[model samples]
Target: MSNTGFRVYLNINRPDPSLVQRFGGIAVASIADSMNRASCISGKIKPLNGAPLLGVAITVKTRPGDSLVMQKAMNLAQPGDVIVVDAQGATDNANAGELMVTWMQYRKLAGLIVDGAVRDVAAIRNMTFPVYAAGITPRGPYKDGPGEVNVPVSCGGVTVKPGDIIVGDQDGVVIINPDDAEDILGKIKDVLVRETKLRAEMPWNGSWVDEVLKEKGCEYID
Candidate 1:
């Protein structure tokens, strides 16, 4: 799969809108970096801040200095689509940048996830486009051939397949397998309900630990 290929094995339909909205951008996955805890890379650029991307994915496998397939991904991408590129875990060369992001924005793409670096940081940040990569760099990628797209690829230690629901935000990216959406949605809904009830209480103060300590006969010192 050294070209722009679409994964047909898992063309899961987008999650129900109501459920998607209820869950918001909450999905369980390990954070890419603990320091940048809320910086999630996958999000829906269009539909404004519309509950993140429901379901869509693109897998990329490229060499150290290659981005031919990434260009193809931009050409083939459609609205609500997410381009996921596996740059072979290379951080030296940038596989994506402002130009490709602009193309994706024009196509109404959701966002991009690359296992490598990307350039044009300032411009991309200013634009509505959401890019989740290892980091940014001034060094651009080479247009060499021999990169795969629309295949299973690992990004930031998460395996992604096409049509998988990629929910991300300032919290970081989470890959939900197509077959697991229903189950995960159930869990998410439960969590949301609990959170809602807890928020309504309004008596827990900023620190729940203080309440717990009081219950345990521990006094707070001024």
Candidate 2:
């Protein structure tokens, strides 16, 4: 299937939030990386720890130099939803900013993940809301021409559909294909269990790595 068609299918099939929460962030990232390497977007943008953002998605499509559609998205978004804008990887114009964030906060939305730039970094940092974008820009955006809302779009190099659960932290953003949510949840559970065991066995002295490497016929040179 074409990329657009695949995205459409994934969006219509919303993922189960209960299962997604069961798996958590680490598990979801691992699963998505294993299934589709391109699904992971690397960066340091994240949400405040313990922020309440779950089971929500706001899909958007905007031109490289337009912002009207994004504003419309903010106006139309409901509570407990994250805005995901596909700006076609535009890093020049700031499609989002403080005012938009203020509006989103008023609506009690989850967070925002944009494929373009955003302004008002300091304001966003102070707010409790989570926002992940490619970069920051001092220049704002021009609201003109056309844009779409509630449509499937790609953000942070990952394709996200409407109503998809978006979990963000210091790590980054990962998209969970709605149809595969259940299966991914099961896999993530297994991973979490295994990691728990490994965590317990890890030595406090930081010698666990050396021991494991020795077992693999490798030596650490001081």
Candidate 3:
């Protein structure tokens, strides 16, 4: 028998609102290296709105092509929570659309990141609501589903649990597990500074590689 009901967790520990905002303030690429480069959601998840987004994750794991639990997720979300949906990476049909987006906006949720497709792009963009999705289609999602909310779910190949921080921008989206967000956030600014300094020191002419080649005594066409 197929499981068609929904499961939800009402209580999840999320980061402090101020802390999430601070993490969001930094560029997604800024903390890329610090996270060991493994936490980024796929590049396919592009920003639907032309701005950055940051919030705690309200994870939803639903059957492919279904969004029943996603609807329930909205009820559980707090202001500034990012709805992170795991739809098994389905690409043919949208997992959510305009109505859901509108409701979420009214609730003052931070943003959305779906590891699947989404419809009603025009309305979503018009609202300036940040949304990242795997793809777009006119096809909508089915509500009848077997799913779970506020649980650990895989979004764009990354395991995201409720309360984890979600940061997305034009570059891409990444999941900062609640366990590591604070520690990583503490050093991200310093990492950014060092990165900026290192970048500033690099030569645009591409001669930096010559030192290593010379060290190895490699003879090659310059």
Candidate 4:
């Protein structure tokens, strides 16, 4: 039973609302650190507006220069779903624009992330709805698509499946598997606490740097 292409997965077991809420408060950097800094989407996909993003993933795998499946994904996604489109990192064609963004806003989607390009930057930049993409171009995407919805896809160098938690901030985006989210959340708490203590240290501490240098047998110039 291999449905290789043009697939659609309707059901996704999203994380609990409380867990999503809890993740919403934490910074994406902290979440990345909790995961050993390996689950982050590539830094090339940047936020159009400086807004925090947190939501369940609604994965879309579209042809390099097409938006048909992405449009279908928009219709299928529910509120608080972040539509993460794997557009194969195509920047020559913009996958979405202001009109689509407005529709997403009207639908109350949490955010949108495209591993490609998007047009209508001027208009999208003014909207509060979170939008992140790898590039911008005036060229628009083709509507006819051989694509899939709600399936596992690669976006910005990260494998994302439907229902994965996506957290984004000014820094960038990171994907979290709902099954491991609780454990990651625990580690994030520890990271936050450790960061707070480090921040509270009035004078910067370089003793650890010296210790490491000494252990490595580095000769000091002075």
User: What's the TM-score of every candidate structure?
Assistant: 0.70, 0.75, 0.89, 0.95
TM-score for candidate 1, residues paired by index:
0.70
RMSD of 2: 5.1
Model 1 residue 136 lDDT score: 65
Largest lDDT belongs to which candidate?
4
Q: In terms of TM-score, which candidate is stronger, 3 or 4?
A: 4
TM-score-sorted candidate list, best first: 4, 3, 2, 1
Q: What are the per-model C-alpha RMSD values against the true structure?
A: 6.7, 5.1, 2.8, 1.5
Residue 162 in model 1: lDDT: 64
Cα lDDT of model 2 by residue, 106-149, tens digit: 88887887888888988888888877777778988997847777
RMSD of 3: 2.8
lDDT-best of 1 and 4: 4
How many angstroms is residue 149 displaced in model 3 relative to the true structure, after the best TM-score fit?
0.7
What TM-score does structure 3 among the candidates reach?
0.89
For model 3, residues 1-222, the per-residue Cα lDDT tens digits are: 533347788899977777777775678887776787879988877888876788888989888778888988888898989999888888798998999998998999988899899999988887778999998999888889889888788888888888888888788987887677777877787788888888998766757689888999999976
Scored by lDDT, model 3 comes in at: 0.84
Q: Model 1 segments beyond 4 Å from truth? A: 1-55, 200-222
The number of clashing residue pairs in each candidate reads 6, 1, 0, 0
Tens digits of per-residue lDDT for model 1 on 58-148?
6666776578878877777667778888776677888888898888889888788777788887787777767777756789989866766
Instruction: Give the per-residue lDDT of model 4 (tens digit) for 91-122.
Output: 99999999999999999999999999999999
